[model samples]
Target: MAEDIEEHEEDTPTGRKKGLLIGLVLAVVLGGGGFYAAFSGLLPIGASATHAPAPSHNADEVAFVALDPLVISLGPDRGNRHLKFAAQLEVEPHATASVSHLKPRVLDVLNSYLRAVSINELEDPSSLIRLRAQMLRRIQIVTGEGQVRDLLVTEFVLN
Candidate 1:
């Protein structure tokens, strides 16, 4: 009975702390080993993903065609608020001449669309993204598919 009691006393909270310390050390060592294995390319996952070079966007593959500046008149409620907008079209190097030939048509679409948009919509800061997308779609319709990659807005100001 005395031996059993001594055994129970030794098996209390003090022994639990030692087990917890060993577990924590093992977890840290294993975690570090796994990280080193992945980082050193011994493991198949992270090394290639982290160290691979990014694809470059060469200027030769794309070209920008600048549009003539546009000045749009805001209607009656806002007195003399003009939205001055300028943009460039990003297209394949081969498409520049064909796209530029259609500039008048593009301008007509932009002017008509901007004139139709409400003053509130023009004044909102975040509306540029929506506006840019809308303009790009209209431009693509006018220019045809695969001609325009993107529309880069160089200037947008309302005064």
Candidate 2:
């Protein structure tokens, strides 16, 4: 009976050790795969529906054009809410002229879109990300593909 008890204790520890080893190996492999995916951009950290990290550009080859700040009234449900937005368009240095020429159309598109949005949509914190994407798409359509690199929202205030 004493020999049987000793054998049981010895067997239990071996099984526990083997289980622990397998768990460790799985943890290492999963951790490595996560790192690989993140670094490879397969999993983008902090990316939003409307925003992504700008692609690399040579310093001398990029330019930014500021737009006039827009103050638009939100729909009446919120009792006199307003949005003040300011942003810049990034473009290739040579395309600055073209983008600048289209500035009026860009503002018109933004104004019309903002006015159409309800105060409730503007109130949600996540809405800014969606709004940014919508605005960027509209601006790009006006500016033509490849003319605008990115939209940098410098300020967004709701009052």
Candidate 3:
């Protein structure tokens, strides 16, 4: 009976030690995995981290000039589809006057370019980026390089 008790006591301690070791290993593994996921941006909280805003090289020297909204009728066979585009031109604070002076030419270029686009092209989901680039290029050409910084498309509606 004494030998049986001794054996039982030994078994209990060894089993508890084994269980503790396994728990410690599990904790370590889980902790490491969580850290890795966070660091790698795989976790939702980590993934939500945003990039720091880019430092302004010109230091508040940027200005926006709102362009007149354009309403252009799509080409024939579209059955009265019209595209309304509203945008702003980003320019140097000092060049807002110069950029605004070219507004008529800018509007003319935009009108012609938009009119020339096929209805199908305007309907494509991926065409906005391309159209923006094209429009920016055209505006820069009219306003002269460096006079216009960027073209921000605020609204585009097709009906």
Clash pairs for candidate 1: none
Measured by TM-score, the strongest candidate is 2
Candidate 2, residue 70: lDDT? 96
- Alpha carbon lDDT of each predicted model: 0.89, 0.87, 0.88
TM-score of each: 0.64, 0.65, 0.63
The alpha-carbon deviation from the true structure for residue 144 of candidate 2, after best TM-score superposition, in angstroms, is 1.0
lDDT of 1 by residue, 47-138 (tens): 35445454466967988899999999986678978999999999878999999999999999999999999888999876777898899999
Position 117, candidate 3: lDDT? 86
Stretches of candidate 3 off by over 4 Å are: 1-59
RMSD list, candidates in order:
9.9, 6.2, 10.2
**Backbone clashes in model 3, listed as residue pairs:** none
By lDDT, the best candidate is 1
lDDT of 2: 0.87
Q: How many times do residue backbones clash in model 1?
A: 0
